[model samples]
Target: MESAFSGHIYRQNGQGVTSILSRRVEGRLMWKQRIIGLHLRSKIDHSYLSQSQHADTKGKSVETALHSLVGHIEKANQYGDFTMVAFMDIEGAFNNVDPMADVEAL
Candidate 1:
């Protein structure tokens, strides 16, 4: 079955208008996504690659990141040490994933 999609433009705060890709994603693609999402979450939740609260499980979000940062800063300050933060630019990071490699990993 073919489903129609309605694209809309919306403005955020004072930002200029942005086009949003609206569509009814369903069928096999949706099911695959749901399954993969759950698997990814499970693998990430208990992995060392995930931070204390940055783990992708429930109740973890920006607030979690903020709390972790605050805790680190507090601990460092208490020890009379300086803390430095470095942010990485990961725009289009997904482009680095190779399709065949992804299939192999899956």
Candidate 2:
């Protein structure tokens, strides 16, 4: 069986609103996740990004990425062979694919 997570909530004094969706992992899971995070971080390809991908590093926001992408597209258009630029964000798409849907609908 897999481990489960617990949710935590916190709020300030005199405030009626509370923060939800905060997770506090157990001790065992925390250690396990740390080890996994270290391994994954080490395996990242530092050279996979080219000079054109200026905002593709860690901690980059979507706004910065859009700025970089727009600049690159504009530069490419000057060559007279550019058609269109397609963008896809596939990070969390797997969860939203709805795998439980009826297969026959395909």
lDDT of each prediction vs. the true structure?
A: 0.63, 0.58
> Candidate 2 on 33-74: residue-level lDDT in tens?
556556554665668666455443576677777787778778
44-99, model 1: which lDDT tens digit per residue? 42644544645355777878788889999999999999999886668866445554
Which candidate number has the best TM-score? 1
How well does model 1 score by local distance difference test?
0.63
Clashes of each: 0, 0
Output the number of the lDDT-best candidate.
Answer: 1
TM-score of each: 0.51, 0.37
Which residue pairs come into collision in candidate 1? none
Which whole-number lDDT from 0 to 100 does residue 104 have in model 1? Answer: 54
The local distance difference test score of model 2 is: 0.58
Pairs that collide, model 2 = none
